[model samples]
Target: MVAVGAMGVAPAAEPNTQVPAGSRHYAASDFPDRIVASPAQDAATGFAVAWRTSTLSAPPLLELALAGDSPDMGRLRQITANSRILQSENGTSQHHRADIDGLQPDTLYAYRVQGQGTWSAWNHFRTAGAAGQPLTLLYFGDTQNKNLSHVSRVIRQGWQTAPDARLALFAGDLVSGGDGMDDSEWGEWFAAGGWLLPGMAVAPAAGNHEYFEEFEDTPQERRVLGGHWPVSFALPGNGAVATANTTYWFDYQGVRVAVLDGTSALDLGTAQAQAQWLDGVLADNQQPWSIVVVHQPLYPLRAERDTSVLATQIRPVLQRHHVDLVLQGHDHTYGRRADDNAALPQYISSVAGPKQYRLSPQARATMEPVAEDTQLFQVLHIDGKQLRYEARTATGRLYDAFQISRDGKGRKQFTELREGRIAPRDCPRPVSPKGRDDRCWE
Candidate 1:
């Protein structure tokens, strides 16, 4: 077991026994780890590559080529990456980033990173096609499991369901152990994704767990942005400066995906700025379908939770723009709700880990079908004016499914795609206040 700070750096230790094969540890290395591709200015014509190298390694460079039908990767185009030094429990390392523009839309490309003589395995990614093209995306919420393998299984199952999903959207709480700064946990996360990463773009929203600060009396136990949030993945920089790395938006085909930092907006006093920016983005969005991914659900599943501030600050913007879907994760339960006042965008929350939380009556009343103590994944398909959504258990059990269609008049009609097959699962009420019992008693 590895001991890490609540946030930020932990005391230096030996390489974690948990590090999986093919994943990079935090220690200095000639090869890169956490190699990923993120949306740049435009999904079709621009993309950014980011990775990490050990402090012992030199600045890295990216080699890219248009993947062709033949196995031979033709001529390589080289791009110099900018390096930033970062310190973690594994010691110091360099984070490298490079943004490429003017790539052909809907084209396949292969890329690899090299620091010193060691190079990363080549990864291939397909660019988004023109607007109105059909697309599939996978969404997961709060995958902070006690053991990363539990979350890994869910992710692999999701890809098995939609192997060609263009993008994976994470609604925060990616890893709660050590506030995401734990290098070993990140290695597990990267290893779990396996080849999917770098091959497919990742869009992550920052959850409360992603934020931490040093205590006035305990500087060594500093907590801040987890050790990896800003460095592990290179997300789009088109967000409010105050919430730069976590807040961003990108378009794939005709769908517009906006990632908001719910924790920062609520705790750091950046709500107004984010709200204003969100309004502007949604107001001007011309995309046929829009989706918002945030850490905390506006309509929380827990009774003790109150997201009125978030609703007041952000919900109006979503309603005004007629967003198609709002995906959230935080409450460790599965739920979907359609606002009575507004119905264009359905609000949903899901957990893809072993963690489970009791769903409140208020949450149960809004959702037609909900689940507890079940790891789940959501697959979304968008084609023309129609959007399809399906929620399934980690092992591939269909739970809830629905479809939304926009008519010529811009009116939206929804249909329950699955009727009798839906099996709603909820844990039994705890017999005692301790809440340690995992079973129900008659």
Candidate 2:
């Protein structure tokens, strides 16, 4: 078996001789794997978790307890999981989910999932605190390509940087296979995250790659949300009726984070509905800070790409609501731009994977301190009236820094903190078809 270590790095060894020669770390065994923790709509009192296991005769379940020094086995509460069978290219497996509630705010809890006769190692997570508390979070862009080999280090580095982070927000394109038919990719993604995934709440935005093209090579070609999405995550189902789990909003601490299904909004004729729902979600926001997470950017950093739909449909709502920050991915490069109009939300597009794209000419003019051929993750801290942001490279080098403070009247003040930051990394020429050019400098 190809064993993934606690650090999430796959060993350099041949495949197990017992299974198929090509079978590696992706195959599911009787043991539960791909365990992930997510926040509830109101994160303080509840949370959700999901995992995958080989087909079993009986259903799976989850056990939880308030974390304490003692084993506390007698106090454990058992919650039956809702299971669904998913057939993919890797074969058939069952996905299990349990929405755990009645939790205490700002408390630590230990939980584990049970398969037929075995149980996963107990993982611990802290629930979000009550309102008016400070918050720390990690933001990541696409971990699509080379997830196991390359992106693993970046994610691990982020964890090392902010081990106490309450949430990890993924912008989108978590995998290259849009359909989730390639189950191995998802396995690699989970393996790359390893134990850190269970320790913090995950909020993922659906990217174009998370959907598969149906009826290809025909006039009726359309995109369909992958089956793995709903099964892999038990997100807050507070989005538009048509866009249930993919587009939802949740509040953690003093911040309200709204994740949008840009792929669905752009392809499935749900843009208007999402826009309207987002308007209401933000308009009713009582949190001190509001952030929006989406796959596509309102301002495209890729030369050949266009985001007219997002610009027209979603950008206005964010501006009108005075969102503090907008995090996005899909350009495969790092670009941050604070609009000249202070009322506009600060826009940032970043990549955490190995894929690299050339920045457009307009990107140089619009985006300051742009980067290419670099993998990065962001650590953000939000207090009462100020938000401090830092972008660090895969090697933990500081790349860009900024701070945003809001006045009592909700007026935002942007402060640039990149005075002595690392020099911008880019390629003089366009990237090769293979995604990188030899002349690239990081």
Candidate 3:
């Protein structure tokens, strides 16, 4: 284990061991629940927010104002939100969304949502600052299983590491059940992030688990975006027409994050469309840094998992655009591959839930610092021409560190910071079907 002081990492905090409450505890009510603030296409001057409620008798409303030392009711501006009714296993509910725009850059604002006649407490968020300004972001992999019980603490620790992160990016598989029928899973996911979900702008890519298809309906497996997705997030609806909000991009400061729906692209035969869309988005990107977040990795880290189709379609577009990094999830393990060719983007696949998987032979041979049975979160800070990235275990121990610096000619130099890092925790024995390996510890 690395020394906390030497690594400049805070000691691991006590894990939250309390069992999550029942689904009824998180059921929709007259008051707003599952409120989330998301990034707009141009996050510097605009943002979007969404929430769920039990009833829709009255139109949903949102109030926003610049945050101040004291709350002044008179300064609040009222905006009516658009609502959509959704039927799920839990029950019928209404999801409301409002896109707030015309705001000052790098400004802080307080906002709240309305449910029927009730109102949610005030939550605040800051817009993106000017380009070239320092930026920090928190990235997480799948929180698919045991979300509240095991993944909650990891999410909290990420917030602790970068409390002022401009965005919290999830590679995906946010819940175990992809159909959106299991509202309890969504509840656990929301509870895992707690207040942090609404405090920072969230950008998530849709994983395989976020899509569901009925075999009886089609001879070929055709996945459909779950009902809960659009209702749960008010993302920038500017992607391939078929994927729309599920596949989008947003610019925060100097970074352009292009989120893709790899599940839909691979299973639903939308790969060509998304590839073309990605090429255009990247071609038009003006940010100094470019990142692609997708649930399925171009390089699969798990044994026997096939990603050749996904890789073939998307990899060329990414390379052509010179994307700096590609963050992925779904293998339920941690594996990173820095290509020998610096022109290729750095590829990383990680997991944040209790679930685990065995590494592929290729991963064991080519990827460095691979791990299993360990939940991790990443904190990335970009200042000027350099980007510093650190991967930390759920216990807050620094596991891997690296820095990427770009030159005036747009060439990148990768530097590994291995001092004070803990040894990789790969399982000696293969992980069991239930994600168990006697030698691997949580």
Residue 97 shift from truth in candidate 2, angstroms: 0.7
Clash pairs (backbone) in predicted model 1: 28-54, 29-54, 212-223, 213-223
Pairwise TM-score winner, candidates 1 and 2: 2
lDDT agreement of model 2 with the native: 0.86
Model 2 — TM-score against the truth? 0.92
Q: Sorted on TM-score, highest at the top, how do the candidates line up? A: 2, 3, 1
Error of 2 at 136 (Å): 1.0
Q: For each candidate, give its TM-score against the true structure.
A: 0.89, 0.92, 0.91
lDDT of 1 at 218: 71
Q: Where does candidate 3 stray beyond 4 Å? A: 1-23, 178-181, 216-221, 428-442
Candidate 1 vs 3: which has more TM-score: 3
Better of 1 and 2 by lDDT: 2
Task: Please provide, for model 3 over 309-371, each residue's C-alpha lDDT reduced to its tens digit, 9 standing for 90 to 100.
Answer: 777899889888889899999998898987556634889998998777777788899888899
Residue runs of model 1 more than 4 Å from their true location after superposition: 1-28, 179-181, 216-223, 428-442
Candidate ranking (lDDT, best to worst): 2, 3, 1
| RMSD each, Å | 6.7, 5.2, 5.4
Please give, for residues 160-220, the per-residue lDDT of candidate 2 as tens digits.
Answer: 9987788999999998884333587788788889987888999999898888899988999
